[model samples]
Target chain A: MRELIAIEYAKLKKFHALKIIFAVYMLTVPGWMYFMNFFFQMEPGMKALFTSDNPFDFPHIWSYITYSASFFNVLLAVIIVVVTTNDFQYKTMRQNIIDGMSKQKVILSKFILVFFLSTIATLYTGLVGLVIGLIESTSYDWYQNIHLIVLYFIQTLGYFSFAFLFAIIVKRPAIAIVSFILYFPVETIIGKIMNADAYQVFPLKVFADLTPIPFFKSIVVSMKDQGGKTPWILDTNIQIILSLIYVLLFFLLSYYLLKKKDL
Target chain B: MQQEIVLEVKNLVKNFKKVQAVKSINLNLHKGEVLGLLGPNGSGKTTTLAMLLGILHPTSGSFSWFNNGTKDENRKRIGSLLETPNFYPYLNAYDNLKVVGIIKNVANLQERIDSVLELVDLKERGKRPFRTYSLGMKQRLAVASALLSDPEVLVLDEPTNGLDPQGIAEMRQLIIDIAKEGKTIILASHILAEVQVICSHIVILREGEMVYNGSMNSLLNQEQAFRLSATNMEQLEQALHAISGISITERTETDLLVTCSEKIDGSSINKRLVEQGIYLSELHAYQKNLETIFLEKLTQ
Candidate 1:
């Protein structure tokens, strides 16, 4: 497994597009966060939700980072698609098998790569959050916000693994990215048409709900002012569990398809 | 001495949707033998190699490598090149081989890569990315990768598919050198002359069936053909028709080709034709080479 990962790492080192996507993600996440913070500070009306407190403070800082990082999952997912589809496009997957790696090893290599990418994204998010929190938080509290890091990791894993599955099912990178983009709208439309809470557990919805946009607090503040009830779904535990299950399902299906499909 | 069997394939078949690409191929490769898989396009040669390498699943039948049924176990001892040269297009030739070395688990990585690069004559261009390479360079890099592990068996499919004449000669020489090292080689090619030059044992596939499989010497040792033509083509035909031991296989405006029993000689045919009052314009005996045999089998 280490050797496989080493080989995968070597392949990625020369893969310029993946490097570009990763660099953009790493740069964009923090840059976007700073810009959003500046905008919120400029607008007094938007600033009333947290009562003039630094949103980058410990407890609230987790939400700030997680919410911003969640959107970049699409970028990370595109990275996954690019790396996975490259092997198929270049016929390197078949060559790997011919060179003596097992089919399981080939697929596992990609899975490991996705996990590695997600882990890196998580660490980068937490590091950025730590820097922002240290500069802004009046009360230093690290342990209180660590669970957000865990949730962020799971969310990234869920998205990247889903991308891996999409690459396997749809071998072309362009089609896979397009399909991945359309997944949410398509699933949401279908879920609303079905109009059953049961169908809310579908893949895209579960991942979206995992580390949700942290605007529920702001919505609740305005709703309280207007005497409206919170329509937010607050079950993080259920979302985490379901997201993990989807991650496992995506991985197993990718493995099955890679092993069963002709290279 | 009995050679150890390195590979044994029995009743191997592959079907793609409605087309049966490879239908029930069976053959054996012994240690240190250069085995050639010969066939034209769509004859299932590539499919057979793919199935044996575990790239394509067999619809039915089974194959064993080094007497081991487990693919992983057997595959670790084999190095294969299937179809086109497949490496990361953006990676240089040296890095591409490094990837293969890691997968195949070769020791002394730098030295092995260098040796293979030298062998394929791509040492100077090893730093160039695969996408920048010409077709021959790509093929040379593939050969370098295949030899990276110094594996016990080498399975190559059309290793010379897109090379110029000189590149083909170099690639053929490389295979011959590897074979001389006593590695078991299974080569698939549509070039009959190339196979004749490099292979000791041959399996000929026609329309997914193994029409011929045996020693190269045995397949090439066909009955010698005698060509004869006379002033009177009609008399020549009548005289050859009256002959019991000989059968005329081909006849054109100029000559009649006859295959006779071992007891007959070219002089006897000539003497008989003379006695029958048919003056001969030409007469010669010739043995069939691999090309003639291949053409015969393909037509059959």
Candidate 2:
């Protein structure tokens, strides 16, 4: 098992796409924080700008980071796609099999690497949120923040797991990236204009709803302020359950595709 | 033969989609023998080797190594190099071999790596990255990887491809030396001369079918006729025609080529010619080489 992990680590380290995505994430996270604080003045306690009592509130941080870096997550997903597709493209998996690695081990290695990268990205974003929250407010209970951190990590895994499945099925990086990018707007537009309740079950909706943000509370606030009808049918518990189901289904599907593949 | 069988393939068959790459290949290798898998491109040489190594799943057949079943335990006793040498380009030769050692579960891996590198004559270049090495060096490193576990049987597919003439000769000698140490080797190659020089047994595949499988010398001796040259012109032909055992093929102004039905040597032919009052300046006998036999089998 230790040797297997070492081999997977070596493979991930050698992948160029993973390296570039990591560099991009490192640069973008700090840069985005600086821009929001200095130029846009979106920092808390600014009278002219919108401010919350605790911008580090789970929902607030989720919305800020997810909205700010959602495009970057898409880019990271593209990197994952490229990394996953290369084993098939270059026939390196065949060589790995010849070298005595089992099919299950090969697929598990890639999956573990994907989870590792997602965990790293999640922790980075959470750290950035913690730093910005500290600058905005000096006093807060760090112990209570564990739940938010756990939720954020789980959400990140959800997105990356879906991307992993996409990559495994398509076996082509460009197609997977395009499909994931187009997924968001397609679901949003269909949800609002067509009044489709089925969008609630879509993976993107589940990810957004489970992202530690009280989206329903925000919607209710907006509705009360504007004198409009309340939106949404199911509660948060159902959404979380659905997301977990999606995660389970996607993982099994990915495993099935990998096991049946000729490579 | 019971104690000698090191590797056995019984009616092996492999198909890719609608095309059958290997068709009912039956082969048996003895200990301390080099079996040459001779065929042209796309004749399923590599495919057969892959199946024997268990890297490929045969459509219908069974093969065993040293009477052990086709499992990881059996695979541990066999080492193979199918297709090209594939390793991490960024890693040095030593590191690459170390990785292979770990995969093959070798104990005292560092010492084994050192020994393999020295065996392949790459001890000095072991620290250099594999990408920086020449094609011949890379192939040698691959050989070193295959030899790391001191496997009982080594299956190499075109091990000398891209190698220079000197490298080819060195590799041939190395294989022969390894076989002398009681290791069975199955070499797949298209180089007829190398096969003839190194292989004790030959298996010829043509269009996914085994056309010939036997001892190399016996295969060569299977040819019915031999070419004979003589200095006497028509007298040699007239003398040869009179004898029912000899058949004259070509009669030139200065030479007469004849074929004998039985296995006859130069001295017997010369004695017969002299007894018939047909004096000859020179008498040369011809035997079939591997190239001719391969071509004949392939064409048939």
Candidate 3:
């Protein structure tokens, strides 16, 4: 396992596109967070629209960090697609098997890659969160805020595992990335027909609800106050458990696809 | 010498959609023998190798490696280069081989990589990314990876597919050297001459069917035929009747093809024809090589 991870890391380092995508995610996240934070404080219209205490305050700091970094997961997912598709495109996966690694080891190597990437993303988000929170928040509760780090890791894992599945099933990077990017709107359209509680069970929605925007939670609470039924998405633990299941399902399906593949 | 069976494939078949890519091919690879698989395009050579390496699932039947051990354990003892060199294009040959070494769990990683690099004659260019390599260099690197583990058996598919004349000669010699090291080798090629020079045993596949499988000597050492012509047709006819174990397989207006058993000597037949007063002409021996036999089998 350690050897496989080292090999994967070496390959990833040499892959220019993946490195570029990762650099984009790393450089863009903090700048994007800073820009959003600056706008909410400086722009009167933005301030009126947001209508909240300093969004970067102690309790809100976790949500701010995770929410701001959440959309960047799409780019990271694209990186995953590129990395996985490189092996397929070059037929290196088949070579790996020929070189004596079993099919399970091939899939396990990619899973380890996903775990590594997700861990890095989680640590980066944690670092960004700490800096921003110390700067903006008057009080700090490390235990409360650090839970968001775990959720962030799971969310990244969910996204990357889905990308891995897409790359395996699709086998073409461009098509896989386009399809993954399009899945959100398609799922949203499907979500509307299902009851709100049932829609929360969807994979991406489960991940999204993990670090629900701080303002969105306030709106949901007020809606409940106005006699709105509390959607199942309000239960973070259910979403986490369901997300875990989906993560496993995606990985298992990816494994099955690779194990049964001809190449 | 008793040769141990290293690979046993029983009724192996592979079908892709409606096309039967590999018909039931049954073969056993013995230890330290170089086996060549000969066929034209779409003859299921690659498919057969893929199935053995577990890259493709066989549609029917089964194959076992190294005394029928589990695949994981068996694969560790085998090194293969199937169809193409599958490596990261961006990585140098050394790094690509390091990945192979890691996968195969080779000890003294850098030392083995250096030795294999030297073995392939790519020590100088091992630092260049694989994409920069010419086709011959790419091929040599693939061979290098297959040899990385010092595996018991080597499965190579068209290892010389894209080499120049000199490159092909070098590759042939390399294969010969590897075979000398007592490693079982399964080589697939359309180049009949390459197989003839490098392989001790041969399997011929045509349209996904095993038309021929046996020793190379058996494939090439069949009864030979000679084309005979004479100035006196009448005397030639009479003289031909005097030779035993020589049958006329084909005849033209000016020539007759006389087939003889392997036990018959050309000089004896010549002496008999001379004794019968029918020798004032030409005699040409046509020994069958693998190309003729392969073409004949394909047509059949």
Candidate 4:
């Protein structure tokens, strides 16, 4: 497994396009945070929201930045698609098997890349959140709600695992990327049509629920003049568990398909 | 009393939907023997190699390397180049070889990569990306990749596919040198002459079926053909008919190609014709080549 992961790194580390895309992903998350911070600070009327705390306060900022950073998980997901499909596009996965790696290992290598990318992205987002919350917020309490970092990692795995599945199924890089991106809206439309209980277990819904829009819940509560749970919203624990299931299911399906198909 | 078996395939079959690509291919390749896999287009040559390499799953059948079942670990012992040189187009030769090294778990990867690039005569351009390579250079890099692990078995399909004449000669010589080192090589090529020189055994496939399988010497040592023509054509033909074990197989534009069962020299045939009051002008020995035997197998 260590060798397989090393092989994946050797194949991808020098890849300029992949590096550029990854750099963009890492930068865009913090860049978007800074942009959002600027937009929020420019406005004075928004201070009323956190119920009793401002959005940038240390504890609130943890959830706020994590919620904001999770949206960019799609970039890491795209990276997954590109990395996996490049093997197919270049016919290198077949070569890897020919060179002595197992077909299962071929798929496992990409899964390693998926996990590796998600871990780095999560760590980068966490570090950026910590730095920004430290500099922007005036609170000595750094550990408050910091467990969102773990949630960020799981959210990345959710998006990236789905992207890994799409890459294996689609093969062609362009087609895989386009379809992977397009599936969000397609699932959104499908999720809207499903009943409330069924929609709670849907893949995209569960992954999205990992980091709900930070202040949106409070804003909705203020608007409603009453505090109540929506029928479609799943408990974060349930969402995390379901997302882990989807990750396992997607990778297993990918392994099965790769074994069955002729490279 | 028997040499080790490098590879054995039994009733190997592959189907693409309704179409069968390889039909029950059965052959045994012993150690230190160069096996030439010959077939025309779409004869499942590539498909067979693919199955053995584990890139394409066989529908039903089995093949083993070094008498071991198709284990993933055994594949690392065999280096193979299937179809084209599969590499990251964005990576240079050194980096490309590094990927192969990692896959095969080659120790001292940097040194191995350098040695292979040097062997392929691409040392100067080792850092150049694969996309910028010419067809010949790309093919050479593939050969380098296949040899990087110093595998016990080398499976090369069209190793000299896009090389220039000199490059082909060099590549063929490299294969010969490698074969001389007692490595088992399974070569699939359209260049029959090249196979005739390097391979010790041959397998011919026609339309997804094995038409011929045996030693190269056994296949080539079947008959001796001589293009004999004389000044008195009628007397020459009659004399050839009178000689036992000599049958005229075809009449070319200027000579009668007589297939001789026994190994008779050109001088002997000339002397025999002269004894019949026939003056000989042409008595050229036409050696049986792989091309002739391959075509015969295919047509059969």
Candidate 5:
């Protein structure tokens, strides 16, 4: 296990795009949150409207930050797609196997990298949530609703797992990236044509709903009292379980593709 | 004493949909034997090696290393470079080798990496990224990586495919030096001369089939043809024809060319001519080189 991590680190430690994309992501996650905080404070009418919502409040701050940061998981997914497809593009996976890495280890190396990246992303999200909440909230319990950070990690794994699948299937960085990027909008369209309840159980829907829009559910609940037909999403715990299942499914499919692959 | 069989391939086969890439290739590579795999273009030489290295799934067959099945740990004992120099283009030679060292689980990998870099003469340029390397440098880095583990058997496919004349010579010498360590090596190449110079045994493939497999000496050990001159050429020609195993192929004013079976040598023919009261002034033994034999094998 140490050897696999060391090998992956040696391979990507100098990757410029990995560094740049991650830097951009790290900066934007907290930077965007701070920008929004200032934007809301400067607008009087908007402040009056959102005064009741208070996205940056202590307990609610966890949801606000996680929901906002979940979108940037695409950047992490792009990193996964680029790094995984790089093995195919340069044919290094074939070389590594020839050099004595088993097919299982090759897939496991990617999993290690995914786990590492998710941990980094989660910690940053948690730290940003803590600092932002401490600054904005007047009084609160420290660990109130902090489980969202853990769910956010699961969501990150779900996104990266699908990215790995696309890379393994497509075998080209550009095509894999484009396919992964297009999947969300495309699934949304497909879900629209299909039954609303069926789409709720879809992988993207489940992962996305893990950290659902912070105050929007309450707004929808109020709207539902007035006979609004907004589609109902699964509970957070169910979504987490489904996301874990999808993560496992994607990893297994990736392994199957590699085990049967000629490369 | 018989050497241990290091790698045993039992009728390994591979098929790509409608096209069969390899067809039941069976051979035993004993320890310390330098085996050369020779073939023309599209002859499945690379495919056979890839299967042994687990890069390709053999359609229906098996192979063993060191009298054991090919397990994950056993793979670390074999070093292979197939078809091309594959590395991360953005990584330097040292970093590229570090990945291989970790995969091979070599002890004291830093020192091993340095030693291999020195062996390939890339120690000076080890820090340059692979993308900035010349073809020969990239190829040398590949050799270094393959040697990083100092495996029991080394498998190389066309190690000098795109090298210059000097680079080719250097690469050939490198392979020869490694073989001198009494290590088992399986080299696949199109250069027959290269094989003739380095390989102790040879295997020729054509259209995914094994056409010829034998020791280099057995294949090239014959006295194919000879030129002889005698004081009385007429008498020498008659006496040569009298020998049961040889035939006079060419007759000229000054000499006669005799094509003979492997049993016939210059002394036997000389004795026959002298017995018939003819004295020979000149006798030259001419042997057929590998290219002609290889072509003949392919055509056959």
Candidate 6:
């Protein structure tokens, strides 16, 4: 397992696509945070902008940072798809297998790399959020906020894992990215057209549910005015459990296909 | 026989939908021997190699390596280059080798990587991305990767497929050196001359079946020997028919070739022709080259 991890790390380092995605993340996250902090001040009337008890508080800074960095997470998911699928596209998987590594180990390495990268992004977001929040206001509840920030990191991982599974199953970066793009809007339109409460149980809905804010309430006024009356399909615990199931199921399916594949 | 054999495939079979790529093929390689696997396109050479390396599963039958262990564990003692070298295009040779080293679980990986690069004569270009490499360079790197682990067995499929004449010669020498170092090699190629020059034994496959397998010398020895040329072609033919132990197998404008069942010197044939009053122009011993033998087998 250790050797497999080392191999995957070397592969991730050698892959330009991963490096470019990471570079973009590093540059854009800090740049966007600083831009928001120094250049664009939030107007007093903007309710969406958290002012008092802002989730983007110090020591809990990652919470706000991750919220703002979600876009980049989506991009990272696409990159993961590309990295995994290229092995198939270029027929390198056959070479790798012949070189001595097992199919299980190869798929595990990809999962490990994705998990590690998502963790880093989540922590980076959290830390930046805390620092920027402290700079904004020092009197915030740094201790309680730090706890929430940790929860946010976990939630981010859960969501990222779900996206990673999609990438794995689809095995094409472009298709995965397009599917990710259409995910939320399609879920929204379908949920409205069907007016089915059960639609909220979808994977995307589970992801939205894990966020600090509720999904339906944020989108529709009727759902919001109901004031928690809408069905709470899954709390954080259920979301985490389902996300893990998604990871296991997709990883197993991917492994089976890879093992049996003709290359 | 068991002690000398390095690899054995028994009744191995593989199919792709309606096409049978390998049909009940069996092969064996001995230590310090280069076995040339000769076949045309889609003749199952590559497929056989793939199955040997555990990249492609056989539809039936079984193959074992070293005769004692599982395929994956035994694979550690074997190295193969079945097709084009595939690497992270963005990475330099050194980094690409580093990744392979890690996956292969080699000790002293850096030193191993350096040594392999040197062995393939790609040390100077080791730091360049694979995308920048020429075709021959890529092949050398592939060879280097196969050599990295210093396995006892090396399997290569068309190792010099796209190389220039000079590159092919260099590769041929390299393969020879590897074989001399006591490594068992299975080299698959369509170039009969290359195989004839480097391989001690040969296996010829046609339409997913083994058409021939034996030593190079034995395969050549099986061909008939006797060439006849005469000034009077009609008299030469009549005299050749009257002679015992000599049977005409081929006829051309300039010569009539016969296969002699027993060893007979050119002088004896000349005496017999002279006694028959048939003037002989040329009489020489016939020896079949690898190309001729291969063409004969293919046609057969």
Task: Give the candidate number with the greatest lDDT.
Answer: 5
TM-score of each: 0.94, 0.83, 0.93, 0.93, 0.92, 0.88
A149-230 per-residue lDDT for model 4 (tens digits):
8877888888999999999999988999899999999988887788677877878888888877776566666666665554
What is the Cα-based lDDT of residue A121 in candidate 2?
77
- lDDT of model 3 at position A208: 84
What TM-score does chain A of model 6 get?
A: 0.78
Q: What is the TM-score of chain A alone in each candidate?
A: 0.91, 0.82, 0.93, 0.93, 0.95, 0.78
Cα lDDT tens digits, model 6, A13-62, are 76766777778887887778676555335543453443444333454354
Local distance difference test, each candidate = 0.85, 0.74, 0.85, 0.86, 0.88, 0.74
Quick one: ranking by lDDT, best first?
5, 4, 1, 3, 6, 2
TM-score of 4: 0.93
Candidate 1 lDDT, A1-263, residue by residue in tens: 88988899778888888778889998988888888788887986876754556777787888878888889889989998988888899989888887788877887888798889888999999999888888877879856857978888998888889999999999998999999889878988898788467666887777776666565666777788998765455388888888889888988888888878888
Residue B264 Cα positional deviation in candidate 4, in Å, after optimal superposition? 10
| Higher-ranked by lDDT: 3 or 4 | 4
Where is model 3 more than 4 Å wrong at Cα? A140-143, A226-232, B232-257, B261-277, B280-286
lDDT of 4 by residue, B131-209 (tens): 9999999999999999999999999999999999999999999999999999999999999999999999999999899
* lDDT-best of 1 and 5: 5
Report the lDDT of model 5 for residue A85.
94
Please give me the DockQ of candidate 6 compared with the native complex: 0.59
Model 2 ranges with Cα > 4 A deviation: A12-17, A39-59, A66-71, A75-79, A166-195, A212-216, A224-255, B4-6, B54-56, B65-76, B121-128, B232-287
Report the C-alpha displacement of residue A35, candidate 1, in angstroms.
1.1
After superposition, candidate 5 runs with Cα above 4 Å error: A42-51, B228-259, B263-282
DockQ numbers for every candidate? 0.75, 0.31, 0.75, 0.82, 0.77, 0.59
Tell me the lDDT of model 6 at A63.
49
lDDT of 3 at B266: 75
